[model samples]
Target: MKTGVEKLTDVMAHFLGHTAIRLPDDVIAKLEELRDKEDHPLAKVIYRTMFRNQRLAEELQRPSCQDTGVSQYWVRCGTAFPYINELEDLLREATIQATFETPLRHNSVETFDEYNTGKNVGKGTPTVWWDIIPHSDQCEIYTYLSGGGCSLPGCATVLMPGEGYEGIVKFVMDRMTSYGLNACPPLLIGIGVGTSVETAALNSKKALMRPVDSHSDNPRAAKMEKLLEDGINALGLGPQGMGGHYSVMGVHIENTARHPSVIGCALNVGCWSHRRGHIIFDKDLNFTTDTHSHFVYEEK
Candidate 1:
């Protein structure tokens, strides 16, 4: 029988070996809506590229983006869970192998040497965020493949306390005007507002993992979501920075109370093919797998 660690390793290897979750119906609907409204020929071309990429990824069983991104994991750990040792290494190894087998574009760069790891693992590769909960024996892990083109446009700023909500909107607006096109229009935009830069940046990344077009539970944040979504769509960035009726696929805002003097906020955007998936495993290794373009039960 496979131990929990072996089970974990198996899943990770399998996940990296395949593309997760097909674009859901709503996502496909939104893309269709944009395609019909898109006006610029170039923008239309970009949209076509995205569509074609998705098809090829499915047909060929390959990643849509060569830059499979810096693999990021948001892990919720159960206190009662066993086999904690070597989890990180297993993840790193999975990424290394996936990079080779899947041929994920070599994205890791050595800052000082300017050399690509080509293997996708380096000093601190495959960033993992942990949330340890009360007594339990199950864990849920969300995996995200954040591409460079989309992540490059991420923005953060600390607004003065007096500026209030309006400042946040302006910051987002300015970022879009400057780099939204390059990040890929019709993007999934995540906004985080909190006490410091780090919190804001982290929350911003978390926001992208949320279901496309879902709003935050906080009433105020939900309102901001609607406002930002409307404002961005008005930009008509269409797909791929071409002009259209919609510039963003969705807008998610995550927030936390900040110090009285600080109004820190950050923005992260995901391109049309925003790649992510979630899996939950029980103590016996019974798990709900929601990656590789399907929802199924898996066991190792």
Candidate 2:
């Protein structure tokens, strides 16, 4: 009989491997929507090529993007979850397994030592962010493959209070104008505003886990999401920056109260093939996910 650790490890490894090869359902849907809306022949052609790539990636059972990226996990677990203590290590082990099985590129190198770990799990690779629940018996995991290209232009900064919300808009637009093309476009932009740069940065990434069509509960932030989406699309960085009618898939904003003195802002961008997955497991290890359509796990 498989232990809970072993079973969960197998499931997570499968999910990680699946994430590499498949674009999530929402991502594919959004891509299709963009492709249908394109008037530029070049942009349409590029979008078709992208869909072709996705089909072949599945048929060939290989990653859609070579940079399978460092595995990052957002674990929202309950205090009453049976295996909470082992969750982090299970994620690490699963990442190692997926690296070799999914044939992910070795992207983890020690910062100071500058040596690639090869296994995709270095000292702090496969980063795990935790959200602890009070007394529930289930956990939800968000898996993201953060490729170097998409992560390259990520940045955070503090704006003087005088700058106001307009300053936040300028910061995002400035970043997009400067290096947005570096990340493959029709991008998903995550914006975070909070008390400090660190919080903003973290929340910016977390914003990426939100559904593409969803918006913040806060009405002002929701308005910002629509406004930024429209503004970025106006940049016309469509279809790998070849230029077209749209520059982004969506813009999501997350914010918290900050001091009177400064406003912290951060931006994270997800490329056209935003590789992310979500799964939930009950105490008995029964699980469900809709991120990857028609996914079936074959234990080997």
Candidate 3:
């Protein structure tokens, strides 16, 4: 018989595996939209190949990208979650199990020792970020595979207040133009604005969790999102950087009020694969997922 945490571990492992093999519905929809907007034959061919790759991935039940990326979890848990105390360990074990079950590529290496942990659980492998929800028994989890090519050019800096929001635009555009092509085209861009480098950097990653077609709740931020998306598409990176009519799937901004003197901004990019999963769990561990809604998990 499995313990409560053990059951949760199996569920998480299954979800992680599911995430590796599939793209979210929103991402697929946007990709199809881009494919239709292009007139270039090569771009059309590339888009077709992309879909074929996804089809093969699902048919074979293999990861869509060999990189598979570093497994990271963004967990929003209620304070009253029954298994809250053991959640961290549960996640770590789940990652290890998924690494083998999904046959994921080993992507976690210790910084100085420089040895791959192999199990996907090391000193800080499978990085987990947490949020506490008050007076609820439900938890929301986002799992992402942060690939090296996409994450390599991630950057952050603090700007002088005088530079203003326009400065933020310049910073993002500069990075996208310089490194965006290498990240794979039709990238999902996440921009974070806060009071410091770390804060902005973290928020930038969180922005990637948003739906590709969604806009910010704030009107100014929503406008900025559209502006950035348009500017990036204007780059004409096309599919696989071969060049096309559109360059990005979308741009998302996650911002927080900063100190009066400084505006910190950071950028995180997600490649075409953009493997991530969103799952909500009740206290009893009954879970539902939107990212891989079509997936059928095998019961332990």
Candidate 4:
């Protein structure tokens, strides 16, 4: 009989494998909506091709892109959950198995060694971030496949107190103007403002896990999202960066109270694919996921 940790690992591996090929419904919907909004002839063709590509990947049961990307998980674990102690090991094993089963692109090359791990598992690969929840027995996981191209344009900086919020706006506008097209626009832009670079950077990436249409809760932050969306779309990079009226699907901002002397801001850009999913597991190890709710997994 399998241990609870083993069971959770197996389920998560399968979930990650499926996520590579089948996009979430929300992403598909957004892509379709963007497809119709395109005025440029070639841009329309690109969107159509994108749709067809997704269909073919699903039907063929293969990855949607050759660069399946480095795996990353954001985990919120209830302190009362039984498997909390085992999550790190469970996630690592799952990622190793998924690399072969999904046949993910062997993207993890050791920097100093200059050789591929060939299994997407390395010292820090498939990085996991954790948040502890009080008084609950369920764990929620957000998985993201961060492809190389999409990860290329991520930027972060600390702003002097004098620069103000407008500094953040300028920083984002400058980055997008310079490299936004590189990440395959109609991008989902995530902005994080915090007291330091690392916090801001982490929050920026977390913001990407939110649904594309969702906005920040803080009114000030929400307004910033709107302004950034409008400013980016006005760039006319459009679908696949071939030039069109819409350059981004949405802008999201996540923020924390910052030091009075400094403001740190970061940007994470998700391409049109926006490959991510969410899953929840109870203490019993029974699980549910929004990304692949239709598919049933059998325990061994």
Candidate 5:
């Protein structure tokens, strides 16, 4: 008989494997909109190629990109959940199983030791972040694949109190101009502002998990998202950075109260592929997924 952790691991492994080949519906919609909006001939061709790549990946049940990327799991767990103690181990085992079953690119290598784990699991590989919710018996997990190109452009800074919001705009514009093109354009930009660099950096990546069309609830933050989106699109980096009218699909900002003396900001960019999935598990481990609703598992 399988333990609860083992059952959860099986579900998670299937989720990760399916997520690799399938582009979420939201992403496909955004790409199609960009394809129609683009006027440049080369940009149109690039968009078509992207569509073809996604179709082939899904049909063949293969990864869309050779770089499957490092896995990152963002978890919101109910304090009353039964498997809370085993969640981390279950996630790690799931990632390891998915690495081979999905045949993910060997992207995990030990730092300093400098050896590829081949399997995506290693110390700190498939990093997990947890948020505990009180008085509930369910858990929500968001899985993100952070590809090397997209992850390369992530930047964080601590702005002096006097630098204010303009400083944020300047920092983002500078970072995007310097490195955004390399990540594959028509990118989704997530900005996080908090009291410290580490807090800001994590929030920045979390921001990317939001729906593509969504904006910050705060009015000022929503305004900033618009301004950044417009400024970035003006850069003319275009689709795949090949030169087009649109450089980014959207801009999203997530922020929290910050210290009076400093404002820490971070940027995380998602490429056109934008691979992520969400699953919710109840106390009994009954699960439903928003991102992989179409996936049907074969009995082992």
Candidate 6:
């Protein structure tokens, strides 16, 4: 007889294993669309290889990238949930299980010790960001499997108050020119502008959660989205940086009014595959699962 806590751990572990390797359907569609538009021969070849590799990964149920990534969970836990007491521990145990079950490449390295967790159970493995709300008994979770290659070039900077909005554009353009190619092109760009460095950085990552090609709610931000998209695509970094029709699949910007004295900004990039997904669990444990921007799976 399994306890609710045990069951929860197992369920999360299973889904993490499956989701970590699968590219969301929308991401797949965007890649295919780009493959058709690319004119450079080598870029085209890389695109085709990417598609075939995706298929092989799915068929074999193996990870699309060997670096199964540092598992990160964005959890919206209902305050009234029955197992609230153990949620954090459950998540950690699930990560440990998934690391080996998925045979996830051990990616968590202890900073001072510089040793791999070997089980993905280091100090902050499967970093979970929790949101607690009232009057609900269920949790809505988004698991983002972010690879280091894509995350390595993430940046944040504070502009002087006079830098104004255009300054953001210049920063993004400059960074992309220097390191964008390293992130595996056709990247999804997440820009965050807020009053503090940490908040801006987090908002930037949240921006990637928006659907591919989606625009900001504010009209001015929407315009910036277009400007950034056009500028990045013009770079011709293309697929795998070989050069072609599109370098960025899309750009999403998130912002908040800043302090009069400071301008905070951050940028995080997601590779072509952008592995992330959502699962909403009801009080009874029934759920609906959606895979990233593209893949969808239903459980009966």
lDDT of 1 at 110: 80
Candidate 5 Cα misplacement greater than 4 A, ranges: none
Task: Provide the TM-score for each candidate, comma-separated.
Answer: 0.91, 0.98, 0.98, 0.97, 0.97, 0.94
How high a TM-score does candidate 1 get? 0.91
Error of 1 at 14 (Å): 2.0
Report the C-alpha displacement of residue 85, candidate 6, in angstroms. 2.8
- What ranges in model 1 sit over 4 Å off? 20-26, 36-46, 290-300
Model 6 lDDT vs. the true structure?
Answer: 0.84
Clashes of each: 4, 0, 0, 0, 0, 5
Model 4 C-alpha lDDT per residue in residues 1-300, reported as the tens digit of each score: 888888889988988888898887778888888888788898899898888999899888898988899999999999999999999888989999999887788988898999998888887988999999999999999999999888988999999999999999999999998889889878999899999999999999999999888999899889989998988888889888898888898998998889999999999998888889899999898888876655568887
Tell me the tens digit of each residue's lDDT in model 6 across 220-267: 999999999999999989988888879988999998888988889999
17-112 per-residue lDDT for model 2 (tens digits): 998999899999999998999999899999989999999999999999888888999999999999999999989999988888888888999899
Error of 5 at 97 (Å): 0.6
Give candidate 3 misplaced runs (Cα > 4 Å).
none
Task: Tell me the tens digit of each residue's lDDT in model 5 across 1-300.
Answer: 577888889988988888888877787788899899999999999999999999899888898888889999999999999999999988988998999888788889999999999889788988999999999899999999889999988999999999999999999999999999889888999999998999999889999999888899999899999999999999999988999998888999999889999999999999998889998999887888766667766536
Clashing pairs in 2: none
Query: In model 1, which residue pairs have backbone atoms overlapping below 3 Å?
Result: 20-292, 20-293, 21-293, 186-247
lDDT of 3 by residue, 204-280 (tens): 99999999988899999999999999998888888889989888888999998899999999999999999988999
The RMSD of every model to the true structure, in order and in angstroms, is 2.4, 0.9, 0.9, 1.1, 1.1, 2.2
Residue 115 in candidate 4 has what lDDT? 92
Report the candidate with higher lDDT, 1 versus 5. 5
